[model samples]
Target: MINNKTIEKFREIETPFYYYDLDVLRSTLDVVKKESENSGYKVHYAVKANSNPRILKIISSYGFGADCVSWNEIAAAIKAGFSPSEIVFAGVGKTDKDIGAALKEDIFCFNCESLQEIEVIDQLASKQKKTARIALRINPYIEAHTHKYITTGIEESKFGINTWELEEVIKRLPSLKNIRLIGMHFHIGSQITRMSVFKSLCARINELQIWFSSRSIDLKIINVGGGFGIDYENPDKSPLFEDYFSLLNEFIDLLPGQTLHMEPGRSIIGQCGSLISRVLFIKNGSNTLFAIIDAGMTDLIRPALYQAHHKIENLTSAGNIYRYDVVGPVCESSDTFAKHIELPETRRGDIIAIRSAGAYGEAMASRYNLRDLPPSVFSDDL
Candidate 1:
């Protein structure tokens, strides 16, 4: 949370910028590391969430592995001080250039999404005279009950390979001598608040494990991709990390000597960040009032992209409360943060804080509308 002192500092910066509470982030990482330390669970920070160089450096300093989905993300992780051996690449599509870059770096593993991807990597690895370790990313058909766009584990999603194709994939593996099938991966969705969805995934994985045992195959690693949700309503509330890790331990039965891995992004960084903006205009509407802000979907897109909500506050106001439809300067009608939200009577030039934006806030910002990108200010720096 930004204190009065921090709010004063915010007034100095330009209107629209990201403010990260490093104290909150470091404490959150400590909780994650302590909770996962019980079972030696390897956690790879998903770089897609927030690849800010400083954030990456801080996370990497804790010796956490990195999970990347693009060649540039892998390069970013390495540049941020994450070791190549601790980096895992996962994505539905990998260009030859992407594969070749990972091959040269000798990345930890590739979470292969299809048989053709495996063959392509094998071909590239053979040309480089190297062996590529891979994990078959399986679509377990589990419904995470999240937004449609964020769901990736369902069979209809074009993410991982369907379960029915497992046999054919195994059959075709003999011809690819340069690739090794190491582990299995599953990612149900993003912003997954339902615990039962993960339990269902564990059941499906157990069934898959039995099928693998029947084939006399021993999996060395089991990477259950992360989608733990954060408390958007309460920015100060910590996520249920201890309970989540405990639930996984109680339900998921691992084979002997099998290592477990996870990719957590939002739950670790979401609440610690906020987008501070200044109210540009206050206009009266037929029913509600409009508090137009300088920040737009171009700065924080979850509201426009996922229909997501973030807590809004009047940082410099303590007057009577009023209802407002907080909106941005973007031309899109869909660029709204909240509707009929209650905030202190706001005026133009008043600082407004959009809470719980650390994860996808600045990371997803764009140059849309030719708007300059928002700069970041850490709590420690303030």
Candidate 2:
């Protein structure tokens, strides 16, 4: 949370920037490290969430691994100081260039999403004369109860290989000469608040593990992909990290030489960041008042894209009560930030904050409408 002192400091700077609370982020990372250390779980920070070089460097210093989805992300993780041995690459449509690069770098594992992808990687690795460690990404079809756009574990999603295809994949694997299938990976969805969904995932994995064991296949790693949601409504409240880790510790059964790997993105940095914007204009409609801001959907698209909610605050004013529909300067009707929001009577030039934007916020930002991209402001520097 930004205190009055921080707000005052922000007023001296420019509007439309991302303000990161490094203290909060460090504390969150400490808790995560403590929990994972206690439970003997290996954590990989998903780089797609917020791949700012500084943030990634800080996270890398904690000895966490990297979960990358593309070639650039793998490079970013490496550039951010994460060792190549600590990086795992996963994606559905990885290009041949990405595969070649990953093989050259000798990354930890490629979370293969399909049989064709497996074949492609094998061919690529064979050409490079390198044996690539791989993990089959299985689509467990578990419902994450999150926004549909972010859900990847459903049957209709294009993310993972379904159960029916497992037998075929195993049969075809012996023919692929350059890839070693060493593990299984499953990622149901993102922003998953329901722990039961994870328990269900664990049960499915246990059944699959037993079935594979019967076939004499011992998995060296079980990559349970990250989806731990954060407290968006109350950004100040710490997330239930202990409970989440304990749930995994209690349920996930591992055989000898098997390790549990978790990819956590939003839960680590979500609450520690906020988007700062300046009120552009106040418009009046028949139904509601609109507090127009300079920051558009291009800056923070979660609301317009996922219909997600973020706690809005007026950093410059207080006490006066009023209602407003917080909106961005984007030209679309869906460019709204908040609908029927209650805030103090706001005027132009006042600074406002959109809270809980650390994860997908900056990563998803674009330069729509020729708007300049927002600069990242760190509390550590202040």
Q: How accurate is candidate 1 locally (lDDT)?
A: 0.93
TM-scores for all candidates: the values are 0.99, 0.99
Poorly placed runs, candidate 2 (over 4 Å): none
lDDT of 2 by residue, 261-337 (tens): 99999999899889999999999999999999988899999999999999999988876899999999889999999
Tell me the tens digit of each residue's lDDT in model 1 across 1-382. Answer: 6789988988888979999999999999999999878878999999999999999999998889999999999999999999999899999989999999999999999999999999999999999999999999999999999999999998789999888999999889878999998899998899999899989988888899999889988789999999999989999999989988988898888999898899999998899999999999999999999999999999999999999989999999999999999999999998999999999999999999999999989999999999999999988888
lDDT of 1 at 37: 88
- Ten-residue stretch with the least lDDT total in model 2: 230-239
- TM-score result, candidate 1: 0.99
